[model samples]
Target: MSVIFGLAAAVAVVAALGVVVAQRTLYSALALVANMVALAVLFLTLDAQFLAAVQIIVYAGAVMVLFVFIIALLSPGAQERLHPLEARVLIGGLAAVAFTVVVARLTLNGVSVAASGRFYGRLGPFAPVLVDRHGQVQTLGEQLFTTFLLPFELSSLLLLVAAVGAVYLSRRRRAS
Candidate 1:
């Protein structure tokens, strides 16, 4: 299990790096799809099957399709010239390294709390009162509605705003 997890993580990292460093938009989008698939695998290994499926379907499939469509619609040419490594880039790299070190230290030293405890291992009040045998979706829906309702509705609002913005931009472009 650990070996599989390691492999998935490694693949995800490489794909994510490719997304960032790839010269072409299409290649970057492809790398992003690979990264999303790797992440879905990781979610499966963590026993979050529902999340794994959602990761694949929503991110790897739908989102990547949208990205590819956008890339195809745009004129195929050098979008921007690559700049030489500057002082800001060096500083950003150092900051990223420092952040990684801090996160590693925190993770290594973190305490593993038992899930059966009163606090319920960080789930707190949001923990499911009764998990049905049906599947993760039921428990997730319960939590999302009862505990995380505000965030869920807010996310929907955000998505609505994004859709509206996309439509407005497309219309403006067409008009111009």
Candidate 2:
């Protein structure tokens, strides 16, 4: 399980870097899809099967399709290159190194408490026993429909608005 998680984490990191470094817009989108799929695999290794499925279906499948469609529609040209010694490139490289060091340190020394005061090992209402008894999907669905219904609905609305905004912007661009 740890091996799978580590492999997925490595893939996610590499794909994330690929997304940022890929010259073509379509290649960047493909890299993003790979990153999302790798994240789904990581979730699976954590025993979050429902989250893994949702990650694959909603992000890797639906969101990637939308991004790829947009990229195809735009038909963007080649990216402009930056000189190796450019200030922006140097700053970006430094930031990447800083980020990597911070992540490495955190991984080596595990976080005990989150900024929100939640313990890292603390279980939520959906305990492992409950999850085993009722199944992960069932427990998650119950919570989504009951405890988190409003937030769930609001997020759906937000996504709908974003999709509509994207379509509107694309059409307006074509018209102009």
Candidate 3:
């Protein structure tokens, strides 16, 4: 168990570092995929089966595909060589550090699963909220549909809008 946890953590960290440090965008994206897969495996080892499934399905599957699609649409070729001047590299590093700090802040202060009432907050209105107690799917489904149906439907709508926006943005633009 500890070995699995350690290995997953190492893999995730290294892959994430590669995502940041790789010169090629495609290599970075591949590294991001590796990081996501590592995270999914970590979730599985932690017995967060649903979370692991969602991680694999949403992030590794859907979101990565979207990123790849965008990369393909935007890039004219396989490799984009940057003339790495000191100012640009420094600015890039600063931006990366800022992003890292933001993520670290969110992660550290984020809700503790060790605390009592921690459900999947991302689902928002479509809340299948389980706090390690009262967590049966049927019971949760009843609660979501009864008390939280409105939010669930809204979230789905938001997803639909995002999908449409992505499709629109990816389409070839006409000359004005």
The candidate that wins on TM-score is: 1
Model 1 residue 159 CA deviation (Å) reads: 1.4
Candidate 2 positional error at 6, Å: 2.4
lDDT per residue (tens digit) for residues 24-97 in model 1 = 87898899999999999998897778889999999888988988888878836657755569787788789989
TM-score of each: 0.74, 0.70, 0.61
Off by over 4 Å in 2: 82-122, 160-176
lDDT against the true structure, per candidate, is 0.82, 0.87, 0.79
Looking at model 1, report the run of 10 residues with the lowest lDDT sum. Answer: 112-121
Q: What does the lDDT read for residue 159 in candidate 3?
A: 90
Per-residue alpha-carbon lDDT of candidate 2 for residues 1-176, written as tens digits (9 for 90 to 100): 87888899999999999998888888989999999999999888878899989998988898789989988888665556658899998999999899999988886555544445555566775887789999999999998999999999999999899999999999999999
- Model 3 has an lDDT value of 0.79
Residue 18, candidate 3: how far off, in angstroms? 0.6
As a TM-score, model 2 comes out at 0.70
RMSD after Cα superposition, model 2:
4.8
What range of 10 consecutive residues in model 2 has the weakest lDDT sum?
Answer: 110-119
Worst 10 residues of 3 by lDDT: 124-133
Report how far residue 27 has shifted in candidate 3, in Å. 0.9
| Top-lDDT candidate index | 2
